[model samples]
Target: MITFEGASKHYPDGTVAVADLDLTVETGATTVFVGPSGSGKTTSLRMINRMVEPTGGTIRIDGEDIRRQDPAVLRRSIGYVIQQAGLFPHRTVLDNIATVPLLLGWRRAKARARAAELMELVGLEPAQARRYPHQLSGGQQQRVGVARALAADPPILLMDEPFSAVDPVVRTTLQDELLRLQQELHKTIVFVTHDIDEAVRLGDRIAVFRPGGVLAQYAAPERLLAEPADAFVESFIGYDRGVRRLSFFPARDLSPHEDTVFDDQTRAEDARDIAEGHGSPWVLVVSAERIPLGWVGTDQLSRVPAGVPLGDLDLAPYGHTFNIGTDSLRAALDAAVLSPAGRAVGVDEDGRVVGVVSQDDLGTAIWSVTE
Candidate 1:
């Protein structure tokens, strides 16, 4: 949807921020621009909506040269969100969110209704509309800003470190929310961030820029992690990107043992034998209908009657678990982190016991990526 051809920018001070950049962001794709300070990532993004005019070359939006488009009309058609939310302090949240649509000549009632719908879309309450920016938390303010950008229902959005000012937990929430919104809306988006992890997590394709705005690599997260362009890009993505990539892979890869699931009716002694046979202390408990129940250790069965209910004993934690049949490596890693014990359990979609994936399985996945 967006293409940059021989784009370059130079400051009045003669510092080259970007040079001869040529790139394409697939329509409706979340293309992230990432780099350190002074890399020109920010400047390149600004040129998209003409916030920063390019010194040379043409930028095209769906094949029409953006330079020829009227700045006011072009901007109104392209949504923009920036760091710290950039919300006006005196404005009510609803008014702030309705800013873009109102500017586009939408009726007052129509704009407000649109704003309310967008607020709900971003997971905010309609009651918060009356609150001023000062009254809302920083995260809430960011949501308001997002709602405002989306207020006009523009075909494109340019977000510059939009989630950076908030706390990490809130930032993650916003990232996940953006992913969900993108999946539904599919707006052509250009996102800028300094954090590599954030770029990888959110970007459909990442453009890594070096000093002077050099484009190092533009590729999918897996491709970049599996094969970085050079030392600079490799260092930027971090040495552990391969393992970090696991978050995208489903946790179902890890499988738990098939026949050892405990349920409400199964005798405790039998469960113990199953666990003991594996040389493990516990077995995953499930319903007779194959839903997850919890877990029980073999040691606990010695204290109970032959038919002692699986639910009756002091239940162990549910095994570090995920659905099996997806990717064992992902499940194994989650299990390792969640496990107080050594192994991770796997359950099927129906919640029935499936198999187990161990740390060794995790090792193989990580090694394979690097190798």
Candidate 2:
């Protein structure tokens, strides 16, 4: 919903902060401007809301040029969030969040109602509304800043390193929260940051600016990670992109076998018969109550009376021992890969074996990264 055409910023001292920027941000997509300090990412974001007026070219919101509208009116339509929250220290959290709506002449009660709802929206409790910004944690203050920017239901948002001031854990939580909000609200956003990883994680499209305020590469995160536009872009993404690619790998790719499983109560003689019938050498052993007991070898049976119990043998498969519900792709792949029998068992929240994750399953999952 935002477009920059031949946009450049000069301070009248012959120093150009940005030059000849030409980019289009699609409606409702989170477009990130990522580069090092003095690379013009923040400058570009400010130019959108008329916070920094372009010296050379025009910025258009939707289709109309932003210069045509009053700066205050344009800013009111587009939410602005910055580092350190920019909250008014003397005001209560709810009062701070209601600032923008109040500026827009919203009724005091309605603006406050919206502010209270926003507090809950950002995972803050209602009690926090009455407290001052200084009383809240750093993360909480940032959320209040977000709520303040969003108080008026703006169609667009300009975020200038909004999450950068917080701790790493809180930054992650805010990023995830913003992503969830985007899934629902779909507001057009232009976010600027120096952190490339954050750009890749949160952006639908990333515009990487180089040293001279030049656009290096702009593409989706997957394409940018798999194939960068140049050596500089590649180096910027770093070698850990292979690790980051795991986010796209789903549980479907790591499919578990749904075949019948054997428990400890299963006799080795019967297991041998089942294995031979299926043309396999071993079977998954389970308890008498239908819980996983591990795998039993067909040839390892000694002697057993008709209904006599079979004692627990050595756990042959590493997959049989590991839990699965919350396991990462790497851990699940490792269990099957490191197994002597080349198979991993996937257990449910309970200890019972739900399915088997075999070498084929692991290979198939890895192959998905390419295809």
Candidate 3:
């Protein structure tokens, strides 16, 4: 556990980064520091590892004053991941992950073996182990950085906007991966981010800071959302706090529209049963494997020439699919909006169609839980 007692950072240039902060980062939980620019989230994070020395007060790790220890030794004991990965350009992925292990005097073979294990743990291909940092994608490089941080098996980790550099899709993937890893490893992590949504998604406890490094509120994500300490925090969390909170609720209770689904192989006469349904005139199309292809309108299906194969006709756009059991309500809503038919297709673990959820149905599901 880390404890801060009136910790403050006053730069020589008369800048105040952190101001008399007092907080405790509990063991085995993620503590996120989030705010807009000049909030000193990064400065607070660096104080833990002694990267940025505090000009006043004290910071302790596991009951020992960090200032009492050598900054170099203290940093080596803690794992840190920052934006853009900060990997050595010339080092192979394996060697980059193995750096700290080798520094601690582990045998070269053992360190490399540890590196190989972490690479797979972070979901990297073994084939990429031989590639340089430049050869990997931005997401891949971030993975390598995470592996390197975990290489020493530190109990605490510090992340400063680590996922902010990647595109939204990859950033979400990385966020999910971190949550998955935290479940298994249970590291005491300190994360920094400007995005309230990212903080709500990954943080067990969030610290909302004001512009002067003043800690405004520190609480669990749910509490922070349900009750903001002041207008500043409310403004920072955005007007969509209620909508964002839906992500915490399970989507399992949602009842999908099973009858609206029609196999692409269904004959025009067989599809006549769907035309009388009160829902949208469009129906989902699926392959023989049960994978979603797109959408098809009942009017078009009704006009199909008798004896013509349904598979030979064109299909409208289907947008995207979200797993019923795994995805959040936000994802369901997103899928519904993207779909040309104003519905979302629910898929199984193997990507086969399970059913569909309409926009109205999804909104009702969200209201049921939120209300």
Candidate 4:
């Protein structure tokens, strides 16, 4: 656990970066510090490892005052991830991840072996081990950075907007990867981000900062969305707080229609007959293995050449699917909205199509939670 007792940072020019921060970051959970520019979120994070010294009061990790320890020694004990990844330009990916272990005097072979293990752990291909940081994609470099940080398996991690540099798709993927890692490692994490949505998705507890480093509100994402402590926090969370809160609600209450799913091997004439009976414009196409392919328009099936098999026809894009047993209502609703067929594809653990839920039904599920 990390505790801040009236901790503050004041620049030599009389500028305040953090002011009287009194909070407890729970062990083995993620705490995110989020706000706009000049709010001092980054500064507070740096204070944890003494990268940024506090001007007054004390900062303690597990009851030890961090200021008393040597700065370099303290920093090496904490895992830190920055926005740009900060990999050494000339180092091979494996060598980069093995840096800390090498510094700590592990044998060369052992360090490289550990590095190779981390590469797979962070979802990197083993072949990338020999490549340089420059040769990897921005997202891949970020994964290497993560692998390097976890090389020594530090119990506490400090991340400053680690995924912000990537595109939306890559950012979401990285976020998911981080969540998966956290579930296994259970590190005490202090993350800094300007994006409230990222904070909502990642934080076990969120600390909202205002200008001059004032802590506005610190609470769980659900409470932060359900009740803002002040106008500043409310404004920062934006008008979509209500919609965002829907993420906590499960989609299991949604009643999905199973008849909408059809096996790909079905006869085109039989599929056309089934489509006519359902009166829906689109039928979900699935493999014999029960995996979803895409949606086939009924009208298109009718126009197909008589001798051509149903599998020979092109399919309309299927947007995405959510696991009804695990995914949140927000994800299910998003799948519904994105689908060309006007339905969310619900899947089971094996990625097989279990059923389909309409957008109206999803909205009704949301209403059930909200009411």
TM-score of each: 0.87, 0.81, 0.83, 0.81
Instruction: Sum up the clashes in candidate 4.
Output: 0
**What TM-score quantifies how close candidate 1 is to the native fold?**
0.87
Per-residue lDDT tens digits for candidate 4, residues 244-301, read 8989888777888877678877777778877689777778888888888888888888
Model 2 over residues 1-371: C-alpha lDDT tens digits?
A: 78899999988777778988999999999999998888888999999988888899878888899999999988898899999899999999999999989999999999999999898887889988899988988898899988888889998988999999899999999999999988988999889999988998899999999877789998988788777899888888888776565554544446676453666665656656666676555567666655666565555653444453344556464343446667656566666666665677777667767777766767778777656
Displacement of residue 103 (Cα, Å) in model 3 is: 4.0
Query: lDDT tens digits, residues 117-186, model 1?
Result: 9989999988899999999999999999888999888999999999989999999999999999999999
Query: RMSDs, each prediction?
Result: 3.1, 4.4, 3.4, 4.3
Candidates ranked by TM-score, best first?
1, 3, 4, 2
Decreasing lDDT order of the candidates: 4, 3, 1, 2
Q: Which ten residues in a row have the lowest lDDT in candidate 3?
A: 270-279
Prediction 2 global C-alpha lDDT: 0.80
User: How many backbone overlaps does candidate 3 show?
Assistant: 0
Clashing pairs in 3: none
Tell me the whole-model lDDT of each prediction, alpha carbons only.
0.84, 0.80, 0.90, 0.91
**Model 4 lDDT, residue 26, Cα:** 99
lDDT tens digits, residue span 294-356, model 3: 887778877878755556778887888888889888778888889988898998879999988
- Best-fitting candidate, scored by TM-score: 1
Between candidates 1 and 3, the lDDT winner: 3
